[model samples]
Target: MKILHASAEYFPYIKMGGLADMLASLTKEQSKTEEVYVALPLIGKLGKSPHWTGKEFPALLPQDDKIDSLVVSVLKASRFLEAEESGLKLYFFQSDLFQTLDSIYGHKEEHFRFAMFSYACYALSQILKVDVFHAHDWHTALSLALQKDSALPIPTVFTIHNLAYQGDHPFWMTGFLKEEPFRLITSPFDHDGKCNYMKAGILSANQITTVSPGYREETLSEPNGFGLSYCLRQRTLDYSGILNGIDTEEWNPKIDKRIFQTYSFLDWKEGKLKNKRELFQEMGRPSLPLDAPLVGLIGRLTYQKGFPTFLQTFTERRHLPHRYVVLGSGDPEMEDAFFQLSETLPEVFYFYKGYNESLAHKIEAASDFFLMPSLFEPCGLNQMYSHTYGSIPIVSRVGGLRDTVEESNLLKFKTGIVFEPNDTSSLGYALERAKDLFQSQEREIVVKNIMNLDWSWKKRKLEYDLVYTKAIELKI
Candidate 1:
């Protein structure tokens, strides 16, 4: 089957979150069975892809002259920068909108920029004769919206990575053309009198998917839905979730050169000690006991990541005895609070202000527990990474966190601890449990259990294959 995966960012080239990593892993694995093609918009700073085909396709729509002229200018100025990585064909669009922006998002004209890019992707997909157009997030939701009522034969599958970032624009952008194209674009995009790209995808897509089943269920309700619950419920038959997958090859602890030691579940204790020794030297340490439990967290330090719970838990009022190593940057208030916590309790906490990929791996290897107190997580990758690295995750019982981490199957593989009533007190309770587990002789069972869990992208790719097949079936 021919599948085209279109997104604004791709891993190792550009990334802001787990979306990039998930797509990168999925396409890489799916290429083994399907003819997978990736379409990414070029941010000028990243420059053209290393290997270039220098190919050009008319990025025009089946519309009139004036709109066609604008499309032609965008397409003429754009080049189809192509490359092959891990048996998948990658096609990147190098255009002024992406180049001038210098970032994947965060532009004042975000809606306009992505709308044009969506059109370009559709044009290229038609040229490529792809069987299915898989649009990731709202950036490519416009493509699905365009294809909804059109005579286009191919089917579209839209994946919602996060519902919070809907591409909402003024409803009057295309008010002049009250015909086919304008009507098509505005009709689905409209939500409470505004152009919401995600609503458009829900209305237009043959199949809609989110990262996890828990998240899928959550988005169908208030709070998590971000006001799109109505649209999602309207498409109940078409919507579902597939848990996000990670590349085990890249994140594996055994062969990774970045970690201080190479070890499996059998030699976990020695491996952790080696990594901890190196981490202590690098991040510095106080006079805490050698066996003090170190919980590690790596991601954006935001409210979504449960930094509020963290700061509250580690504050002067109610402090955690176990140490913490945090790596990330976001929301100045959260950052400052963490900084203060670390300063006040130097022996108990260490905060790294920004992200370090290698350090993330090292932290996963070194720590006894991985902290993901996220209030809401849509298939978190770090928890899985932590599990595979033998760092038992202490997570809040929400979304993917609850689904992935379970207390069942103690003799065999079991997931980590889950805390309810997401708050500082609840987090403190989970940490205390972790501290108890850390000192216990049977701790190896937990570590061994974590190592045995399958966190690979292989199984999830087959589900995607099924979803693609269903999309084609729907179109027929």
Candidate 2:
């Protein structure tokens, strides 16, 4: 089978979140069994890459009169930039709008940008004659919407990495759409009658999928659905949740070059200690006690991640016997709060205000406990990375965090610490539990069990294969 994955970002080229990582791993694994292709918008960085074959496929797009005042009957011909990575064929659509983009997202014309890109992807899919078209997140959701009523019978799958962002655009953007689809879009695109790309994909695609089973359940209700619960219920029979898997090759502790030392379950204790010491030195901190648990977190420091709640917990429990380290930047208020806390309590807290790929790997390997007190998680990869590195994950009992981490309460299946979301007291109690576990002999057992667990895409890709096959069957 030939499958085409369309998204706004791809790893090693452009990345803003887990969507890139998931696509990179999923396509690489799928390529081993079937032909695979990935389509992305040609951002400034990707266009400048040496491997970029300026090979172009020129196609005309209908223009929105409100947005495209400079253009005439049809917009200027957009070029599809062709390239190849590993065994996958890559197609990057570039237009005047994309020529100046230095980043993958955060543009004022986000809706217009992705609408053109989605059209380019659909045009390329027909040209390539791909059997399955998989669209990721709101960025590529419009592609599925475009293909919903096309004469070409290609099967389409829409994967929702997060439903919170729905690409809500003004209805005037309908000028970009061909008359048939605009007429066919009778489904609910909620929120003050705006055209919602995420809802469009959910209502139009042959199949709808989220990252985890627990997240699927959460999104079917009022709170987690983010106001699309009724629309999701309309397609409940075709919706599914496949838990995401990580790329083991890039994340394996036994051979990772990013960490200070490489080790497996056999010698993890010594390896982690060395990594922890080196990390402390790198951060310019004094040596910590050997038995003290080193807690680490890496990702956007936002309300969704529950960092403010964590700050409250730490403020109230400053004497807790644990050291904390965080590497990420977001929400200016949260960043400043964490920075101030680190300054006020340097002995217990350390904050590195930005993301570093190498430092993230080191943190996963060095820390005795990985902390993710997320109020809601679609499918967190860092926790899985922590499990692979033998770092116990202390997570909230919500979404994928609940699904992936086995609570220490279950002695036989103990892997990490679990607590309630947004509850500072619960987080404090969980941190105390982690400290006790670090001092106990069972720490070794928990680490050993977590390392032995399988969270690789090799097994998880089979589930996707089934979803693709079912999509094709339904299309026929």
As a TM-score, model 2 comes out at 0.93
- Candidate 2 lDDT, 1-476, residue by residue in tens: 99999998788678777888899899999998899988887777652363666677643423322344332222345667788787878887777777778887778878777877776777678778899999998888877866876777589999999888889877776544534222245335555678788887888789889999999999999799998888889888889899999988989999999999999999999999999999888888856655678899899887888988888898788787888899999899999988987898777788999877889999999999999989999989999999999999999999988889877554687878899999999999998898788889988988999999999898779988888988998962
Candidate 1 structure quality by residue, lDDT tens digits, 1-476? 89998898788677778888889898888888889999888787653344665655555554532553454565556666777788888887778888766567677777767877877787778779999999999898878866765566569899998888888777776442234333453765577787888887778889999999999999999999999998898887888888987888888988888898989989999999889888988887735455878889888877788878766675632444577889999899988987987898777788899877789899999998898888788888988998899999988888888778875545354578788735777777777778778888768887897898897888888888788888999863
Which model scores highest in lDDT?
2
Cα lDDT of candidate 2 equals 0.83
Worst lDDT 10-window in candidate 2:
64-73
lDDT of the candidates, in the order given: 0.80, 0.83
